[model samples]
Target: MATKTPKNPQKKHDGRRKNLIDNKNLKSPRTGIRKWVYRFFVAIIWFLILLVPVTIYYAHDLPDISEITQPKGGSTVMVMDRSGGLLASYGDVYGDWLEFDDIPAVLVQAVIATEDRRFFDHGGFDIRGFMRAMIKNITTGRMVEGGSTISQQLAKNLFLSADKTLKRKIQELLFSAWLEMNFSKEEILTYYFNRVYFGSGAYGIDAAARIFFGHNARELSLIEAAMLAGVLKGPALYSPLRDLERSYRRMGDVLDNMVEAGFIQKSVAEKTKAENVQIVDKQTGGDERYFSDWIVERAASLIGRVNEPVIIYTTLMPDIQDKANKALQRIMDQEALTHKASQAALVSLDMDGGVRAMVGGTDYTVSQYNRAAQAQRQPGSAFKLFIYLAAFERGLSPDDVMRDSPVILKGWQPKNYSGEYLGQVTLREAFVRSLNTVAVKLAERINRKNVIEMARRLGLTTPIVAE
Candidate 1:
């Protein structure tokens, strides 16, 4: 009876637990807290495990910054003017780089407003814009609207090729993520504004302003900035110096963008636009295209491959080339109208192998077939330099005697230009006079291979042969 004292006194229990650990599950008073800690650690690990895919997708979804932070300019191969002055170059022709601190806020605002209205608001990938682009691409069945921001453009310039594919987009996204992690927005914007092509062979905005407008980037007026910004679409197409009307219209579009983005007031935009941003006409008179063509060919030969464009350092006199160009233009203009399909090409290089004069074509814009060194047209009697060398190297001085006569070589017949068949003449007279018979006779005796070899050793770029 004493053992059966019913201790089921419905202990008026408070529903709220006094301890965080469940009392029923406690293995021991000592082990209770340890079990709770173990479960807490398990929950934390499960949460992290679930977040891993989200993190990976986020990383892949982010913009790639690897390209933008790279050294962008000065990789260009510069072709110096014959006087050792830097005339023209290819690749990124920038001596000075623009940094965040040096860049003007106005320029930054202009680019952000004109290029991407929501540049600052978005992560590297613009979600709203991307969705919009996706809709357009889906509906229109074409990749019409590209959702690339200023940062993405920098990435493309620095690391990616200009390929508009899904792979490029995915790669761009990953690279953009790296970029965001590495650089600040201002730094990204500075690189974007400084590295993007603005035309006239200018790689960066500073170079564009200086090259075209002849003003520092900081000194660029709103209208001038608009004109230079317009060149980003197509430098040659929107070049103010090349196409003033197109430039004005393009700049007007940029002004509209600036106004819409609230970077500039509408009234101010209209006033600036009306103030005549007429780009002054600029013509590079010392056109070194012949040398450019020559250098391109030479570079291809030296590198031994032509997969990508090669940059060449050349010794070309721009002024002299200009004079030669003008002179050749006059001569060709006069000659072309008089003769049908009658072409003339002149290449004058110095003894040290520097091109001093060149006339590639009458009009390169019309016909880009560079004739100076590209064409294989018979030099007619002009190629007599080879023959003179053939005779001279054989101990025949300028005043030596030579007999002009008919000769045959391996089924080919050789004869003098003179129908009178001049029998004997001095080597100098024959050389200066370009007599063919004696020159051919000397070539036959001197061995044609040795004669051609001498011509090659003295810097004949192209192959030569004596017949």
Candidate 2:
């Protein structure tokens, strides 16, 4: 009471002014929260405004969804022998179309586990996986992980080129969203199994199963399924045919992933990993690969661009082909080093001009040059047959005496292979001995043009210089 009595008017006014200033500066928590909420909405509005134009720009050239039902790229070319046994396949090999139910559950589980663990939970794009991949890439300072989902990969493979452009990425997102909206999860997986590329030119799960396991998709075991699923990362690089060790290691990773995803027990995964996976021997017709390659080229020439799957039944006899391969290999193994011969080719044609067996080289894996078809080698002693036939047609008897000594024609001397010449020999003796000089003399006597004409008539399409 005493202090109030002594209080000055100026002090009272100062206190009131201070209270008003404090009240003016005060703010409610709800007001601050409302302000932040307003800003968030404005930012979202701007983002949508920008995204609309960008989406439109990338969407203009989007592929038609109707085309998804049809197959794309180089069509499969299946080459079969005379007895309908598959020799080889070129281009994209697609198996029979499969529905969702037709695909093995183990295979489906393996793919889901390895490719996208959250595939079932996410709607087209996986935010959690994308974020994780982004964070991992950022931490590693490199693109060690990809943010693409199965849906996005399928969309890109089905409709777009693998261009890592911003436009392509946007298109992929849009297409994936569209796919999610239009197709069910089961349908999406069905399309994936039917269209995705597995190594070795396989375009579908069924084809991969048949190619790698020699069976249908329904027959894929846990180990086989894991191996096939692992090939999805890098088809050519991880293909068993390309690298068995790498493929096996990748299969172990896929099995581990399956265990992590709770699709299979860890013990089961371990057992499956330890089990021996029998891969179908793609080298069954390894030597015939050269023949298959030739057949494909000839087929392409006969039929323009290959736009659809085709079956080519050729005159190749598998038994004869095996024999030819063995014969060339045996010769190369036994005498190749001594003669310094690195390559050899053999071609057997039937009387009807059908190629029964063709071995392009000693080892097709090492060299694919078709010496049987592509080489332009000198006929050497082989040409003597044409000369002898021409002489026979010119009314020369086999018993007629002919000089086997060196003969000079146009300053070119022809000598026998043995380098030792018999002065005079019967035509039959010269023919049997493959005497080059005698054959040349006979050709000169009968006119060289007749020999060339005979060669042409005998199905020799190669150009021959008459000298």
**Best-performing candidate as measured by TM-score:** 2
| lDDT per residue (tens digit) for residues 1-467 in model 2 | 35546459889899987787679576534567798998899999999999999999999999888877776566778999999999997786788889999899998999888888899899989999999999999999777677889999999878887667898899999999999999999999999999898856688899888987889888889999999999999775577765577788999999999989989999999898888877776553488987987887667546644468899999999999999999999999999999999889999999888999999887765455567887779877878888888889989999999888867877888778889999889999998999888887888899999999999998898767785
Clashes of each: 9, 0
Clashes by residue pair, model 1: 62-177, 63-175, 63-176, 63-177, 64-175, 64-176, 64-177, 65-175, 65-179
Each candidate structure's TM-score, on Cα atoms with residue i matched to residue i, is 0.47, 0.55
Off by over 4 Å in 2: 1-31, 71-89, 284-467
By lDDT, who's the top model here? 2
How far out, in Å, is residue 269 in model 2? 0.7
In angstroms, give how far residue 336 of model 1 lies from its true place. Answer: 17
